[model samples]
Target: MGKATGFLEYTRINPKKRSPEERIRDWNEIRLPRDPEVVKTQGARCMNCGIPFCHSGVLLNGMASGCPLHNLIPEWNGLIYKGQWEEAYKRLTRTSPFPEFTSRVCPAPCEGACTEGHILESVTINSLEYEIIEKAFAEGWVVPRKGKATGRKIAIVGSGPAGLSAAYYLNTVGHEVTVYERSDRVGGLMMYGIPNMKLEKRIVERRFVLLKESGINFILNTEVGNDIPAQELVDQYDAVVLCAGATKARGLDVEGSQLKGVHYAVDFLGVNTKSLLDSNLQDGKFISAEGKNVIIIGGGDTGTDCVATSIRHGCKSVYQFEIMPEPPAQRIEESNPWPEWPKKLKVDYGQEEAISLSGKDPRNYLISTKKMAGNEKGEVKEVHTVEIAWVKNASGRMVPQEVPGTEKVWQADLVLLAMGFLGPEDRIADELKLDRDSRSNVKAEYEVFQTNLDKVFTAGDMRRGQSLIVWALQEGKLAAREVDKYLMGKSVIK
Candidate 1:
């Protein structure tokens, strides 16, 4: 609201990205630095709508229309327009614990829900977010604050976005919180599953330092429910919060799934990220993507990551397959109104990289790999695929019916299955004898993170199945509140 005619005066501008010919040669962040004047001009595009739906952070009609974390978008945009970087960063951290991660990788539901999006391109909300936070880091305005010791001890099971957000909120409430991660570092998925090009590991480490200086404890390489039993945590702490993500990668049940050269996307990403961080490809300890023809199945973020990773590893060629039909390039049907997530075709970073490398898009929409053809030595060499079309049967449920005579075979030396996740692994649930939903996710109700057992709570993908990082953080906060309420007979966390 700093300038009434600001939105009309400035056309939408975005953060410049590294050139394709230069960026693909290495695994680094694509976003490049630009003048603060340009950022202010982009911020000037906010129309200052009366409703400010971008900050609502709720799902309407099964689609996220606003920021899931309910970010204060207008306030920060106005602050940025006024050149108040520190205040903007403070307002940003009020709701989002890790803007560096989300701003870099979030799908930007807030922008789609923006009123400006109806007429012109929406304000560059995501880039503004990234700038405000990154500037805060550069100026050293972001620092740690220790609580006044409430003498209450809490333990978080996983250190992903959910677990990290839970610890942040809980510690701010004057509780002694310690986070446990199975890996050698704090960030669970952000540390391993995500590649450095999209979200650099240094960003995670920077925040981890702040959390450590704030009196929050982090126990790395400590697996709860295995090294430290669940019962032990319950006995020691007043309440236990489980934020272990859904690590179980969904696998293809097709024939020859067991053949060599076939791998799970998460395993490939995790190992490759570690190897890249450890020695920058000097060691062959993990699965290498170098100089092989790669076929990635599934079209979500994970699949996109696979494509980018394969390309960075010097793969000869990369192909991504999606079972769903291609989305409309512009917008959803007219029936889907404003504030609903647009079901539109988006060229993510990976696809952009692939297109930059090749002359065309790498994704083959509405195609599925049916089977694998392997050589006599038991190594996968080719993949059999078929195109599909969705049609409503007599029962009215849309089903994927294959197109006859559309069967085709493609050569593939390496295949990575990036199909989403089924649910949280059942080992912890089976060990604790907790109830589960139909999807095998822990049976914990929304708004409250309580499990069937007393004083036991769940959050993040471990409870809600595979979901976005913002949702995971929100769930973690809500769950921590429920745990605090259960322990102290009152609740204050939000």
Candidate 2:
């Protein structure tokens, strides 16, 4: 450790954020630049624990407990404490291919598992990571480093985090990688699923430019199974890596779901981002929430993003519904002890903005929508909801029991279903006849990443259901290793 007693001397400090009122006016990121000295002080708070569980990257009690990339947290923290910014950046990039994205968006499971967090506040690992990478970019330390050509060709389907990470590593190992994206832009989820207020599109664009210069090829507006035959890729490339994310949105099964003005959260967010990038949102090509009372179904990150985006669109009123009960204000020490991800209440940026604008949290817990009421014009007008109680049924399983006489109708001009994804779209699976698990995810073993089809591999949300960007990166790296080995009889990717 750089400072043995640094944990006791310093409390956790996070980066400054733009005020809710000021930031909601535009689509820029909410966080302001953090002071380098302050970040160094925060980095010093890392304790010299005998077993650094923060780097374990394990899932405990159904929640992530540490960095999925197994980042060298303590090493880089010590480097930053000693004012070695370049060394810290190097240590960061050694494991993480895209700290710029993770630093901005990842929920920081590493901090949740920090040794200091058991008794006191955890070190600001996420902010410190962002600072290190940003400094590296400013200092021109991040440049192209291409490996000698291996003369082997690989095709990566999808250009999201998983695809990009696989392309980066496989290219570095001297393989010819071509990433295919159906959209005009690269980043799938990062570009569209997430709002710009959290991760700016320009950040993704910067990485895309660097990746292109480093020798990877990007083919945009090309759908693999539809636009091009899936077998053609298998015939042309030595191996095919499918990082196409789980994008089939789960639909609300209630009545009136097909009404106009009702949409999936991804569609709503994607359209807005595409329009914004095309012309700063001047073309008005997206579903508008302006002056409309909005209802968002679901209570995860997607729902939060919908709330914030609707607010930015100048919505009249917004309401978010979560089927599950609210989490505890603090971790239940008796059940969720140290090193397990604390199941606690967290007010994300979108919730903060909603609170500022509406003078309320805008979230309704233990609520489920019954149906949507439509106006004569076929647009959504009202949402009927019911309170539910989780009670044991005859099967001895907890099931949602609707409370009698608890139905209420709320005004809703636009309803966005932010429920999670089901799995990857069936187009590719059907075209390639790839085996799928019970959950409909591509059937590929972890670490091996090989599908039943010869020379075909799958990773990320396509293999494992919808998950975090960090997990996608991990899968991509692992899959790239397997692909390299399959091509060259063995791999040295790690």
Candidate 3:
């Protein structure tokens, strides 16, 4: 709308990243700082469609269609094009509580649903967002907000994206908010589950400092259900919001899964990050992938993260296994049409680094792990796998059926299970006696976010199971709104 022919005039240019060889040597962010002029031109590429699907924030084919936070995409893009960066940052923060976190970690479903992507390439929405927030921070435009005291007290369990979001909004409305983190630091999974190369710890710490300046209280290294009883919090606070993530890592149930060298992906990532932060890996408390041929059992983001981390640790070789078939190189429009998340092959950072070193992608599609073989010391030594085909059963459900004569074995010094999570842990849920859904997640309806218990609520992964951080942020914001309405009988939070 700003340039009229901007969409036609400007081709999309992605942000630059450090080369694989250079980046693999250290634990630092992969993306280079964006050039302001390049970002402005990228912003001009937004057509500002009559119907901006980029911010629809809906679900199609069970995957997120657009920005889950419903970001004001067109408005900010227009602002950036006109050289009004401060205003663009203001428009961004109107809805998003943490653009810094999402700009780094989110898969950017918004771009997938962009109108421009339906024809030409999508506008560089993600890159524009990253620049706007970074500029805001550098210019000191970011500030804490706290409303007049409502005298209401609220407690949030877990200091992850969801919990932190709820705390931010609730504190902004002048409610006394206290966040309880079981870990030694804040930002839950963002603090440790995520590797440093993707999202630096300092970015999270920066936001934590702002939230503290806003007067929201933080209690670290203290778990609610363990250090103090759940009932005590229920009695102490006017309301309690459970943002405890779906942290029960799904186990790889197979022979020799108990081998000493086999470990959960979360444990591997978390321990490595903690050790890195505490002693720069000098403590020797973390698992080392050095001098090991690693096998990752799962082809998700977590698995990709493991591959990257392993490369950083100087792994000899690595391979990722996926039970599903490989996605097509391009979107199959007949099946995966526009507005739905496109199912296509993408060479992520991990695969890029692996390919740079080995001249081949590390992912193995349509492969399933049968079992793990261990050495005399009870340490995993090799992984047994088989290629499979998806076939319809009598129930009309697609299931993995073993292909004939496809068994294979590969040497593996370490095995990482990146199969995702099951649900929230039982400690807090059991103590609170909260009802659960069929999938073992806490029973809390979307938008409502209220549990069966009085004055108690749930949001994020605990309520919806394993999901994107964007969804968690939205859930937290909505849950905060519901809490505000319940407390004041009318709420100002939108």
Over 1-494, each residue of candidate 3 has an lDDT whose tens digit, in order, gives 56778999999999999999999999999999878788878988999999999999998989999999999999999999999989999999999999999999999999999999999999888888999999999999999999999999999999999999999999999999999999999999999999999999999999999999999999999998999998899999999999999999999889999999999999999999999999999999999999999999998899999999999999999999999989999899999999899999999999999999999999999998999998899999989999999999999999999998999999999999999999999998888899999988999899999999999999999999999999999999999999999899978877
Best by lDDT: 3
RMSD of each: 1.3, 0.9, 0.7
Tell me the whole-model lDDT of each prediction, alpha carbons only.
0.87, 0.93, 0.95
68 Cα displacement, candidate 3 (Å): 1.1
Model 1, residue 213: C-alpha shift (Å): 1.2
Candidate 1, overall lDDT? 0.87
Candidate 3 residues lying further than 4 Å off, grouped into runs, are: none
- The lDDT of model 2 is 0.93
Q: List the residue pairs that clash in candidate 2.
A: none
lDDT of 1 by residue, 1-494 (tens): 75678888988877798977788899898889978898998887888899999988887888778898899998899899899888889999888878988898788899989988887788899999999988888898888866667789998989999999889888877889989888998899899998889999989999999999998999989888788777788789877788899988899999988999999999899998888888987798677778888999888899999998898888989999999988887885585777788788888888898898888999999897899989999999999999999999999999998999999998888999999888887666887888999988888899888999877789999998888888998888888778777767787666
lDDT tens digits, residue span 355-462, model 2: 998789999999999999998999889999999999999989999999999999999999999999999999888988999999999999998999999999999999
Candidate 3 has what TM-score? 0.99
Give the range where candidate 1 is weakest over 10 consecutive residues by summed lDDT: 330-339
